[model samples]
Target: MHKEEIVLLHLTLFHIKRLFEQAGIANGHFKLYDSLDVQPVHIHKSKADHKKAILMLCKGITEVFKETPPDEVLRNPKMKELLEVVG
Candidate 1:
């Protein structure tokens, strides 16, 4: 990925992480698997509450991205794709 795209991805993930934290999702975080052929991003939470945490994060994705800047998000195609997927 280009530097700009990487930056945008990180920014978006940061927003998502913050949202998860605010929502009280335990151990909420993002895992990037760029070197592998897996999904580019994965949301992870404490195994003790894995299912509930993941469901909450999935449900909150759209709201989280809605607060992010469109221009910065649109600058990276991957970010745009992710937004669409989440919504």
Candidate 2:
């Protein structure tokens, strides 16, 4: 990987934040993160929302990694934790 790739990955932190929001995460308030390059992510915890949100995030990331050489979704244990928590 090159510096450009690293930069691109970091730039996509914003994209992931959007993804988190789309998955129902509030992602903290903007004003709270005014001086920071990145704000913390939050997972939506409502009874009806969490399951769907986690499923959505999982499905979306699985698709994103589909064309890659090897998928690392298996390596992300937090996803499992989220599944258990939501279930």
TM-score for all models, in order of appearance = 0.32, 0.30
lDDT of 1 at 31: 31
Q: What are the lDDT figures for the candidates, one per model?
A: 0.43, 0.40
User: Candidate 1, residues 1-69: lDDT per residue as tens digits?
Assistant: 553454445445445655445444423223322222222233332232333334444444544456544
Clashing pairs in 1: none
Model 1: lowest-lDDT 10 consecutive positions: 31-40
lDDT of 2 at 17: 39
- For candidate 1, report its TM-score: 0.32
Stretches > 4 Å off in candidate 1:
28-87
